[model samples]
Target: MYGINSLIKSGSLEAAYPLHSGTYKWTVSGPLSDRQIYYKICLKITNYEMPRTEMEFDSSYIYKCYILDCINHFGSLMFFGFIMGRALDHPGVVISNPVSEAFYRNCAGLSCTFEMAVLQLTIWFVRSCFKMFTKLIIPYLNVKKRQKQHDSKFPNQKLRQWESDYLLNKSERYRIAHEYLDTVAEYGYVTFFISSFPLAPLCGFLTNIMHLRIDAYKSITLYRRPNAKKVPKLICFTKLLQATTYFGILTNAAMIAFNSDLVPKEIYRMYYNASLEGISHQQFSKIPTSTVYSFYKYKANEETCYYNQIRDDNQNKTLLYWWILAIRFAVLLGIEHIVFLVQGFVAYMIPDVPYSVQEQIAHQKKIQSDRRETEFSFNINRKKSVRETERFVLIK
Candidate 1:
């Protein structure tokens, strides 16, 4: 859709930077080390860095400037999550020997809970920022017609030109890799700490609403206004999404298997334990809803005692739990690999450009080649005519 839209040269493509070859220079003030210079210049010729030969900065309005030298982008997000998890993870202080009934929600799962909460929050925050900022600014970008309107209506207004090479811009230095970095953080970094967090979707709802207005203000006064560049695709983002989806699947399975004690034992025992015994599943399923409560962990201590659940032949239980978790992980891992192969096969079979579009492009290229050839022949003929006339004059 975006490719077709951009093919029509629409202003909506402003969210994407042109994928072209161009000279991009560093205009940063600080003494850049040799390695830093190499990475910034040689490595990043064409990126969000330099969409054009020159990028103009807009300083008509003032915005907040922070000394981010002390701030580590990756560390900050990770630490924020860790701190939030720790701060909110108070499950009635830490108990040395916790007691949990098969009926009770085990609080020992706080670590997993904290880990999931942190990851979900981080993912949602990054998502909110990306979606909000990208949507708000693309409209007013180098669409000539819109720029003309802004000029006619507000001649005195000063607009921020595109800060493509924002790394050089000390004030907005973070903008350089903000989008990609955020996605990496959400999909890659936090997931490493723990598998899955269910609250991400819920958290995204609140952040999206708030970021809508925040980004609107930021676009008008804060960020640079670059001309609309056509985005062929978000290849990187799509990869991230795919990778995260696979991870989410495996992570959810792990979370459920591990956190069984955190939820109702009936859920775990009836469903998970059912797999261990064929008869129990049939028996449990045949029971009525109201009477099913009677069939639950009717044990004298298993219903009220966490230690009884944890310590009673706990070695066997621990081994079984781990074996189940490992089996689940392996199965999911295999499925991911299969899905990846299938996706690659499908992609290979499918061409990015449709046949009709490819034909149109080919026709346009042929027309251009014919026009150029005719112009070249005309030039040669004119030159020959001039030479012949000059020779004839010389002979006379």
Candidate 2:
């Protein structure tokens, strides 16, 4: 959603320095090493040092700067979440755990409870920002219609002078750019908090399971000398959980990245121009949402084509279309499922199994006690019968 200029202005390390082909050079200080240049940028954080080798020199200072920049960004964002988490009650969001008692009581803890609350507040803020940007500031941007310049050097077609100049002004352009970035940041934060809804229960379950496993292992080691060498099968279950979580995070990140990039430059231009010109709300509403979906679908189809590269000649086209549709459907279904889970349908369906398991075990114990009572009564009756028989025989 942001251009190179926007990122640089926003203090992103990745965009801090000018790119000369494949290499990045930084003459400035703060998270850099080796005055000398290197072949590849090795992103790291270290104190500045004079370059001893050409490789170290080639690595450049930009990489380390990028790392520090990202760390700072995340730190600031987390802090923002902490502060905002206290304000609202996100209906579907969950907070699973608090690292400290203070955090638990603070109302803005990073746990599911607090995070969800913050998410709701963030959403409200985003909506307000969007309204202010679109309804108020956007009209102001279109006010001064500067005559846009069309360079004669690459002119095959006529270009509007005002349109060209509007986009070139550093301040105007940055405003347009930053608005886009800010929207992304705000919405991303809200969605992130909302999505964390599942994390609390999952964490609690895993924590309890880990405690049980640890206790069981300790007991086995102290008392049962046998089967010490055999590893627990449940360890594999933990690994599976880790794998699924990692994969899901990766996929989600990719999707968000792709969607953000797919945003049309024309839309940005339209919003900026409309804001300045006082475009009618009715006309603005006519802007097509389908365009966004079309672009997304186009790129997604390209991926489907790549997957269909080795398919049979007869079914490739048909298969590709079907595959794309299936993928779209699957995505929709997954999203709906997530919504349902957030609304407590799925969570209610799988109400804490450990509690049920404990109840079942307790019930089994009661049944066993009743069986024992019945057996004891039967044995006492048999003993009396035997005594009576023996006494009768003595009399005879």
Candidate 3:
């Protein structure tokens, strides 16, 4: 029955049929008088409860989590390549000046990343508190409500005791699905918009480290032992990770190229020999004398100064704008190709199974085959000896 239940749960079987627990009745045919017979039978099957003392933690889960963290970190670095590679902005550029608004916008990404990290942590903390509260308090309230409906004092006492025992047992059981969902959420949060903040990996690491400790403490003190489940692989999460990897590469490339000042700075440095300060001063000097009504800010501006790096000729994008735009696209394409090539090279170089492990697996298979052959020969010999001994005894 346990095997059947396991098979059903694993999707290897449709159902276990014709087995039930109930009173069965049938008419007796051989009796002197027609009589009906009734038999009460009950068959119950349940999962073998894993004891807390015997629970073996799988280290692969931890390794996978760290691997995901590393990926997110690396993706963030790639997204903000200028931080490590080259100086994109001028050294003395003032962040507060309206002319340096582009640089400010770039810096805003970092701020957003930090904000998101805080938000994720706060959400996890609140969720954990709520879960603990409901687990401890809700069942007691339910028991109290049931107690009010029972009128007899003695039965109520027995009922309360049973309810207390049930609640204690229930509180000990851990819901693994909740943990799995939490991990998934954390993974998504770190990987999906990682380009917006290069420090996301750091935040993720701190969160995961704390989360690991909390989970360990809960398992030890608050929750009962969880059932041991055997899974071939984390198939769903593995696929999700693969998809995220590809998406991250593309997303980081686009983010660096468009969201940051890296491309424009490069274009300005290579194509135009003028300094950003000089250009800003020239644009400011050329500002129209006529007062312009700015509806967005609801203010009248004496000078119509453009904060963007585009040309001020009739407010239309100049050749430099198109050139910068093209360069950005080129950078995006180049990054994707280079990253994918490195990924392929690394994957090819690293075999999933090491040579040592492969040899051990082969040796085990060989031993099993040899044992099976020996057993087969022994079985044949025993059958022949048994037939001969029977024939000899009959003849004697």
TM-score of each candidate? 0.40, 0.21, 0.53
> Is 2 or 3 the stronger prediction by TM-score?
3
Instruction: State candidate 1's TM-score.
Output: 0.40
lDDT of each: 0.40, 0.36, 0.48
Instruction: Output the lDDT of residue 122, model 3.
Output: 48
Which 10-residue window of candidate 1 scores lowest in summed lDDT?
58-67
lDDT tens per residue, model 1, 284-393: 11211222222133223221211112112221334444545465556556655675677689878898789899999999999999999999999999999999999999
- Highest lDDT among the candidates is held by which one? 3
Give lDDT tens digits, candidate 2, residues 41-74.
Answer: 2322222455676434323343343233333323
| Candidate 3 C-alpha lDDT tens digits along 331-360 | 999989999999999989998899899999
Q: What are the runs in model 2 whose C-alpha is more than 4 Å off?
A: 1-105, 108-112, 127-396
* lDDT, model 3: 0.48
Give the 10-residue window scoring lowest on summed lDDT in candidate 3: 36-45
Residue pairs clashing, model 3 = 172-224
* Candidate 3 segments whose C-alpha is farther than 4 A from its true place: 1-165, 168-174, 193-195, 220-228, 274-301, 309-312, 376-396
Q: What are the C-alpha RMSDs, in order, of all predicted structures?
A: 18.6, 31.7, 22.6
